[model samples]
Target: MIEILELTELPRAKAAGALVADILQTMRSRAAVGTNLLDIDEWTKAMIVEAGAESCYVDYAPSFGRGPFGHYICTSVNDAVLHGRPHDYTLADGDLLSLDLAVSLGGLVADSAISFVVGDARPAESLAMIDATERALSAGIAAAGPGARIGDISHAIGSVLGEAGYPINTEFGGHGVGSTMHQDPHVSNKGRPGRGYKLRPGLLLALEPWVMADTAELVTDTDGWTLKSATGCRTAHSEHTIAITEDGAEILTLPNHS
Candidate 1:
């Protein structure tokens, strides 16, 4: 289902987006070496409750995932890229951590993700992977606007990641968000420009570009949720929710402190 926010709903969308961004930033700051993954989930739950926001992930039962996510946030580590279920694991130095979150505030929803290195150890390959995703995300956002097509954004994102030498995976990419966490108008990471859905004002899209270091193939963890690289190499993911407006695409998930 595709949703176009009315002018009155934009404020609520902004609020939800800001809350999502703030919570992710807070989690990133609190995540450190030896921090348990469960602790991160707990922190996310507390913050969501404090904000009076509902988690889109908790109790989420999608076809691809096992029923009921049963978690407040997605904590993807190292080889893990998407749908990472929190487990009884402690983070260690040099671990690449990706956190994806979506929440509803005032009946509007926003989603975002960020990947960063934990602790003081930043491996070169991991840093490069993270950088490529971030750059690709930026390119995608730049390609979005009131009249731009979804393919334009995809092409822009794919160009960066492909140039950086990471294979693109289309099985899971970005999507629309509004009254619910996931909506219609699937936005792939790579596509031909001038094709696909045409953008319109008030449309909200979550554009995420993720890549594994050496392979486009993914393997599901025994938990039945976490998606990891087939080669078990490091990976990174970056995402942001944006709203198409008359002027251009307005990024709603930028860090509040930034």
Candidate 2:
């Protein structure tokens, strides 16, 4: 369902965004060379409860995923790009890690993702992948505003990824997010501008731009949660929940410390 939030709801959205941003920052800081992915999930769980917030992922049962995500956050390491369920593996140096989180606070929801290398790792390829996703996310948000169409955002994001020589995947992309984690108005990573839903004030969207290094295909892990690249290529994902306003699109989930 599409939820066009009222102007007053924006503050609640920011609260939710802050909670998500703060938790992600905390988790990334605590993550070390030997930290396990499951541990990160546990840490996030405590913070969510402490904030009096609810996890949108734990009970998330979408058609594309198995019912009840059964995790507090998504921990994608290296080849694992999207929906990386917390497991028993410990992180190693130079591992490209991605954390995707969403929560509901004050009856509003916010989502965000961050990709970083663990420990003192300086892999050029990994950094480039993360940079590309961040750049694509910026392009998408820049194209969003009142009266702007969803396609415009998609086109802007796609152009960035295409220019970087990465293939676009439409199977899973950005979507409306508000009172709930996932909502209507699926915003593909690639599309034609002025061909889809028109933007309006009070509308919130999570414009995520993710890509695999060598292919657009994704494979589900045995856990029925983690989505990895078909070619086992490294991947990266960047996202932010944005609200359309009179001035332009306002990003709600930027890191509080950044």
Candidate 3:
């Protein structure tokens, strides 16, 4: 299921990526104390409809998830990390919120995620965890380019989180993304460089680096979708979709409004 966009198709990929990034950033801005997670999902749905784009989540029934993900965006709170299904929970001060979004436009799909603190209570641990994931994401992107191997990106990401004293989880990591959401060439957060699929132009990869504050173990919530830290420690996730090109890895998921 690995998809490589032709040079002519890259423009559509960029458009889809920009839409996803913009929506995620918009959701981040709207999320605050007292904000309902379900409300976030609604907002995302509205934006997708207005843009004439399709949500890669809704109707998404992967083997790992419950049924059709019926939600437009993933709203992960403090302890939650990935596949965070939007619920009726209300955000609170100091709550660490992570939003993961994917949208398909012009027949191409792009995915990205961001972690931040809601409200004014800046918890030091949460901020540190968020920073670590962000830094690792940047390192992973830097390691990606034509002629590079998938392990190079993984090693680059792992080096950052490992040095920051965070445990890495490989069960769910980055993967190839294109016309559909998740694709092949699974990219682990930590691995040996020079050991995986060799990169090339036109290849699109969603590089995400996520970490838990204390342990690598994850426990699924009762909702059968949200993945949380086993120890209930705070977690952070950062991701972006990049397209490998002749110039290097072009980050397509950057917010156009930023």
TM-score of each: 0.99, 0.98, 0.98
Query: Positional deviation of 194 in candidate 1, in angstroms?
Result: 0.3
Off by over 4 Å in 2: none
- Candidate with best lDDT: 1
Q: Report the Cα lDDT for residue 170, model 2.
A: 95
Task: Provide the global lDDT of candidate 1 against the true structure.
Answer: 0.94
Q: For model 2, how big is the CA root-mean-square deviation?
A: 0.9
Q: Over 4 Å off in model 1, which ranges?
A: none
Candidate ranking (TM-score, best to worst)? 1, 3, 2
lDDT string, candidate 2, 181-211, tens digits = 8889999999998889999999999999999
Weakest 10 consecutive residues of candidate 3 by summed lDDT = 249-258
C-alpha lDDT score of every prediction, in listed order:
0.94, 0.93, 0.93
